[model samples]
Target: MDMKLSGATFRRAASTVTVIGGSGFIGRNLHRALRSVGARPHVFTRRKPFAHAGRVHPAVAKSDTIFYVAGSVTPALAERNPELVEEDHWNLNLLLWGLRETGHRPLVVLASSGGTVYDPDAAPPYREDSPTRPVAAYGAAKLAQEHALAAADWTTPVILRFANVYGPGQTASAGYGVIPHWIRAVHARETLTMIGASRRDYVHIDDATAALLAVRAHADRLRATPGPTTLNIGSGAPTSLDELHRHLERAVGGPVEVRREPARSFDRTDTWLDVSAAGAALGWSPAIGLAEGLAGTLAATRHTSMSP
Candidate 1:
């Protein structure tokens, strides 16, 4: 697909942007990117995000664009504490309600999970129209969030079903953030545990940020429309655990000892995403490959670690 959009267009479109979870892994990078594109972003986030549904201050009702990235590390954490899963749903529904009540119709960009939304038993490269049979609590929560957005009739929503997003600022010790976890283990020379042979479609943060910017640039048209539009954001390439270990080894310039463990029953064996719709709709495609993305991630992580 032909991916073409000028920077000036993005600047014009992203005049007033709002990010709910601006401190998050993706949100931080997105906030920075939006600023670079000459957009004024209002960030709304609590000091303690996992505590409960932090009230959405009425001040955010003026934003023309809103990116909903505020949610727990649900993939690994939600299953343990089911109560936290509802926090995102409640917060979003309340936020939408508040926006409508205040007469604000911002273009909402939701971060959905392409990795968990579809039934793994059905197919490999899951599309936007695929049947949503989330097997995990996190996936179920994400699906519910999608439904809530659909129900919110005030504003237009662009639901981006993201794959395993990995890049700088990704936490290493949360039982999630596999890429960062591996990088940290390599830096510390710790044993790398190979839990399962399951493959996942990993999308770099740069590409994800670019897609968000594109969506923001088209926010006006997207909001003018009535229904919500969903698109899959991924590299469309599946990488196995063993392959990821090898990539990490190359990135760290050292050997990693793999400790094979039993795969979890909830884990999907092979999963990828079809991003053609995003390409066609947003005029965007992933420019960074996995190898280069890993290198950039390692470089950024090292820089962060060495900083005072």
Candidate 2:
């Protein structure tokens, strides 16, 4: 069976886009954006992605552009399984060999965590140039991978240090997402817990992908010029967990019960972002507000979520 993108799509997907772990939340959303631009996205994953099973990699590394989005989050996952995380990050470097043979150095977009890339105390909103003092295994691993990409001689490396991303279809389980968790807790009549009330800049995935595509538009110019550009893609304003909860309540149309858990020892007090570089460089800024984004996400979850 021929497993190629359609003829019309071929024009846009000419330079095959490989998104490792593209089936994951961030990657799936990014793939949607890539398709909109007529880019054929091959999701390199262990399992077939929901809609694009054929695009699943039986053997990838032959693709043109490779976006590495596979990694573990949650402190427990990272703390208890550091070796697996390290291996995943290390394997990304191996892509350099295949990328080298393609003749065209594919544009590489790394979905790094903006909320943890820099020390919270150094600046009001974290910047790429800010002093980085990652306190968790997850942050440390991402930083090390960024260093590896820098040294790997990648054709064009754009590091998107992303803020806490929340939108529809985001997992509301114990592992991730602030808004959905609240929605679930509210729906379940469980407790909505806030740890440290740590402030963070939240970017809707729609806005996040817009920021990424903006960077891609400049990849050619960026490749000709040496130097990997590190950008923080987020809304500059910081919203406290408490504030986010208030917004969540309004969006869900409810007054949910609340509980405060003692701040985790590893948790950063607050880590908003400074997106000036992305704005100045890529001319991208997040347009979705908290309540509006959350409201949309809530409606979307009703349709897409398994539990509802």
Candidate 3:
């Protein structure tokens, strides 16, 4: 299949990307990517502005582009505090609607949940056509927001169903990233307990960013094409828990003790995304596998630690 960015698909000069939830893990990385591409990125955080404070918290005016990767994880938080989820949905809609009200046709990119987006048994190696049955409250919330985005049109909207994104500079104790938590435990010389088998298509941060950027580069096709475009970024290979432990051990050579526990009901034994659609549509594919991604992330983190 051929993928080209030209004609009606491409919109001209949508600079000044406004990133909502720019304080989150994926948002930070994506913000960097946008800047690297010479796209002026406006990071909208809830905190009192610092750094480029003038440009940091710009009003929700439709300008260039918008990448929305802000949302909460943890099923318990969503379950116990449904109001929080409702509030997020409300704030998220208002933000997007504000953008729509303005004449800014931003190539809005949404960081959706790949793990919880689809049902556990909704066909192994889920395709984009697979039926979605979210088991977790967070996934349902994301789905609702996705629908809202599809409805609220500005210019172009792309939904990135990101797999479990893991890398350095992540806080494991916050209880989100599995890889970061495991890496921290190993680094701190603590024991590790896994909920279920480690089988998952762990896409490296670099690969995920690259795929998303490719979408930006080809925004025209994405925009001309009717309906919201969803792409899955992953290694397309399931790395089981048993396999993950051994791999981490080999890489770090640390005292990585493991104890088995009852897996969370929301957890699946094995899950991975069928990335062929991304390959065919975006000319994007995951370059780094689990072991390679882990190695690179470890090296970077250790280097940061050893820096003077």
Highest lDDT scorer: 1
TM-score of each: 0.92, 0.87, 0.87
What overall lDDT, based on C-alpha atoms, would model 2 receive against the true structure? 0.72
Enumerate clash totals for all models, in the order shown: 0, 2, 5
Off by over 4 Å in 1: 1-14, 48-56
List candidate 2 stretches off by more than 4 Å: 1-13, 48-62, 305-308
What TM-score, to 2 decimals, does candidate 3 have?
0.87
Tens digits of per-residue lDDT for model 1, 1-308: 12345864555653666888888888898888877766777786777332234445644676777889888755778778887887678877877777775476677889999998898678889989888899988888999999998888787788999999999889886756578877787667788777878889999998998899888776656766669999999998889888888888787787778788888766777889999999988888899899889988889888988889
CA-only RMSD, every prediction = 3.0, 5.4, 4.4
| Model 2 TM-score on a 0 to 1 scale | 0.87
Question: Against the true structure, whose TM-score is highest?
Answer: 1
- Tens-place lDDT digits, model 3, residues 1-308: 12333332234325455677778777778778776655666777667331132232344464555677777655557766788889778766766655655555667788787777787766668877778888878778888878888887665778888888888776675557678877777666778878766478788777787776677767767877887888887888888888888888878965479878887655656678888888988888887778877877777777776789
Cα misplacement distance, residue 210 of candidate 3 (Å): 1.2
